[model samples]
Target: MPHVIVKMYPGSSEEQKEKIAQEITNVIIKHTGKPEEAISIAIAEVTEDLWIQEVYDKEISPNKESLYKKPGY
Candidate 1:
């Protein structure tokens, strides 16, 4: 099974989130060969003020060893 966590600022509509989840699920199925039923996804919404410490420092910075893809900073 493959799990995906999507973190973004709040305000996206339910319809948009649904499309995003479906699209991402398709991508995961294509790449990892995971079945749709076995995949899990979660969307985490955080405020801009807390984005740095919550995501950048905690996930993008110190977790390089486990990250396979990252955006240019």
Candidate 2:
């Protein structure tokens, strides 16, 4: 089972989130051959004020070796 967590600045609509999840699920299914039911997606809303400490420093910077696409900012 592959679970995806998308963390970003909060502002996206519910429909946008749903579309994002669906698109990700489709890509996962297409590439990994995993069934849609086996995949789970979560979107965490992080404010700009706390982004550096809450996400970038904790997750991205520390885990750069494992990242497929690195953030520019």
**Top TM-score hit:** 2
lDDT per residue (tens digit) for residues 1-73 in model 1: 7888999999999999999999999999998998999999899998999998999998888987788888587
TM-scores of all candidate predictions against the true structure:
0.87, 0.96
Look at candidate 2 and tell me the lDDT of residue 42.
Answer: 98
Residue-level lDDT of model 2, residues 1-62, one tens digit each, is 89999997889999999999999999999999999899999999999999999999999999
Which residue runs does candidate 2 get wrong by more than 4 Å?
none
lDDT, model 1 = 0.91
Q: How many residue pairs clash in each candidate?
A: 0, 0
The TM-score measured for candidate 1 stands at 0.87
Decoy 2 TM-score against native: 0.96
